[model samples]
Target: MALKFKMNRKGWLAVFAGLLLFAACESDPVLTGDEVSYAGDIRPLIDQNCTFSGCHGAGSVQFELLTYNQVKLKAAAIRREVWELQNMPKDRTMSLEKREKFKDWVDAGAPNN
Candidate 1:
């Protein structure tokens, strides 16, 4: 019984050490080559946060941000309101990382993609 207990304890210790090594060897997630796109990244974010609450959608703001062109036209304003001033969504707020992505998109000339 004593020998069995010792073997099990050693086995558990080895497993724990292996797990630590595995976790330490793992790398942080990497971003792929595809640059952020308006359609892919920006539009979806706007659709969820901006357009849905009768905020920037139709019959809400004087300018509707539902479409790509509309958003593109107002990219500078979006950057100011969202990134610099951080007064958008009027309820909660986007994560800082998301806000950075939005700023990057705007800085990249607000592409239609």
Candidate 2:
């Protein structure tokens, strides 16, 4: 016996759109060497922008970014919020350079160096 499945126009379009998005996302150039740094680049940026009182700091309701491990653990979420969604830093606007750094870091597998 054989089974057959059919998708409607909308379903096909949705699948195509998802594939396109995935391709676009995967097309980002990978960084190496000094392109992105965790201690020198990312930590300072996070400390200044994210880990403030009542935010992602210690004793806060939200996820704490007080250490490298915490930051590394939440790198994906940080990238999404900061780069894709552009909703991070709350009321403050993150600079393009800063946003790019975040994107590059996460895209580089969020190394802890």
Candidate 3:
């Protein structure tokens, strides 16, 4: 004998949505021609834009980006929020050049160098 399983419409939709999200997250990052450096380019931008008091700084509720390790851990979120969504830096706006640099760094695997 064979067993059979059934799912409702909502269940099917939920499964499809989850698969789509998984695929999106798994896809490789798109790289730009120019190289983006973590220390020289990205870190400065984070310090100037992201790590202010009450934001991503020390003792804050939000994710702290004080060090390379911390920033590297949240690299994906940073790309999504700052590069794609353009919703980060809550109080201020980052220049287009800076945003592109951030994307490039994340796409390059958020290297420590």
Candidate 4:
């Protein structure tokens, strides 16, 4: 019985280690080469986090950021809000993972991948 328990524990540890390794090695898909500047990175992230979070969705916000062109139109403002003013992504639910993704996108020229 003790041997079985030890084997199970080792197996679990191995599995956990493998999962961590995989997660650590994985990278976010920010911007590909065949993409535009506005569509790939900014719009989708804003739509997912800002709009879908019930903070700025349909009938929720005065200005919706649900589309590429919509977000593209406010490129300077969005960059300003996030990078300069630090006033966007109004939810604490936005993990550093998401923030890093957004930053990487911005750094990658805010492309449309």
Candidate 5:
């Protein structure tokens, strides 16, 4: 004997809807703007902005950004302050281009390279 399964219209619709929801919830990995490098792109920016005397470099703040480990630890906060809130630096603002670079770096998992 063979077994068969049949679904009513409502059941089929429910399954279809669930599949759509599942697919919609799945997101592809984001490829940020040109590849950003910690040494080549991010470090210089951080040095210029947050690494001056009495700043993030000198351990003045609760955290620091002088090294890759420190910066990675604070990556989420950095993104929020620099990109989302735009209230960091406390003295000046980063340019649009620089902010975009930072955002890209953060999106790329804040890699040390």
Candidate 6:
């Protein structure tokens, strides 16, 4: 009797696992933009605006915003500068779209994309 009960429970567990997998297979897709690549999007924003005067350029700056790794190192402070302080570009040239995109990129685990 005990053996039979265990077998029945195992069968139900297997069925539940199959149903979970099938449900996952039917989910909607995740849409991302072509320019959403971190290196392509956010990096360019920093390079064009912040890094011009060797600030975060070919050589590392007080704030390293070149590569994802460099950017991550100073990400919090940079985010503060651009998002919180709004003291970036020193020229008020960074656009709203670029700022929102960068914020999304940073919020999304800062993926290399």
**Which residue segments of model 4 deviate by more than 4 Å?**
1-44, 83-85
Q: Give the per-residue lDDT digits (tens) of candidate 6, residues 1-113.
A: 35544458889999999999999988844665534567778878877887665577766546555567988777667767787777876887887787777667677667776
Question: Who wins the lDDT comparison?
Answer: 2
TM-score of 3: 0.68
Estimate candidate 3's RMSD in Å. Answer: 11.1
Return model 2's CA RMSD, one decimal.
11.2
Query: Candidate 6 regions off by >4 Å?
Result: 1-7, 19-29, 32-35, 58-61
TM-scores for every candidate against the unseen true structure: 0.66, 0.69, 0.68, 0.46, 0.66, 0.71
Judging by lDDT, tell me the better candidate of 1 and 2: 2
Model 1 weakest lDDT span, ten residues long: 1-10
Q: Candidate 5 lDDT, tens digit per residue, 1-113?
A: 99999999999999999999888878765666568999999899888888877778775667677778889999989988888888777765678788878888899899888
Backbone clashes in candidate 3 total: 0
Model 2, residue pairs in steric clash = none
List, residue by residue over 7-110, the lDDT tens digit for candidate 4.
58889999999999898778756545643334554566776667864666766656767766665566666666665556777744655555555655556665
What are the lDDT figures for the candidates, one per model?
A: 0.82, 0.90, 0.88, 0.63, 0.84, 0.73
Q: Which stretches of candidate 3 lie over 4 Å from their true place?
A: 1-33
Taking all chains together, the TM-score of candidate 5 against the true structure is 0.66
Give lDDT: candidate 3, residue 88.
Answer: 83
Candidate with the larger lDDT of 4 and 6: 6
TM-score of 2: 0.69
lDDT tens digits, residues 4-98, model 1?
44458889999999999888878643657656788789988898889865588887756789878888889999999889988886775689888
Give the best candidate by TM-score: 6
